[model samples]
Target: GQQVMQIPQYQHVQEGEDFTTYCNSSTTLSNIQWYKQRPGGHPVFLIQLVKSGEVKKQKRLTFQFGEAKKNSSLHITATQTTDVGTYFCAGEVTGGGNKLTFGTGTQLKVEL
Candidate 1:
């Protein structure tokens, strides 16, 4: 079975600082998705990547998928109090059912 792993399980950033998180998969992934979970809130889909070596940006945030499609990363240009939340990366394993395996997740805390 394929598994997804995330690094820097937790982060503490001062407001206006930058933050980043990395994710890797044990096997090639068909596609990968990113989600954000605010404190005391449910997970919310942020973006999805299907092509190798793909990169996408939303405002001050950037997402990247590795050329091997086995790794990914997310970077935030600047940290804000509102950015305090957990970021998760999920992917579908090769030949796997329509189910997704989620990484451990990176928890972000921003302070003023």
Candidate 2:
């Protein structure tokens, strides 16, 4: 079984500051998916990274996949109250098919 873990289990950032969460996998991953879950809400898919060393950006958010394919990171620029949520990284190991191992998650708090 593969394990996925995220660092900085909790993060607090002032509005206009930046935030980041790092995800690491026990085994090489074929692909990784990022999700955001607001308080009392189910996880919602945000983006996916497949290629090694891939980098993607959506608005003020940035995502990067390590060249080793075993780690990934999500960064938010200029944090806002709307950015408050738990971020999760789900990894699908090589040959694991559609099964995904989800990380413990990183809870983010933003305040003015």
Model 2 quality (TM-score) = 0.98
Query: What C-alpha lDDT values do all the predictions have?
Result: 0.94, 0.96
Best by TM-score: 2
**In model 1, which regions exceed 4 Å deviation?**
none
Q: lDDT of candidate 1 vs native?
A: 0.94
Worst 10 residues of 1 by lDDT: 91-100
Clashing pairs for predicted structure model 1, backbone only: none
lDDT of 2 by residue, 74-112 (tens): 999999999999999999977776998999999999999
1-112, model 1: which lDDT tens digit per residue? 6789999999999999999999999999999999999999999999999999999999989999999999999999888898899999999876777789999999999999
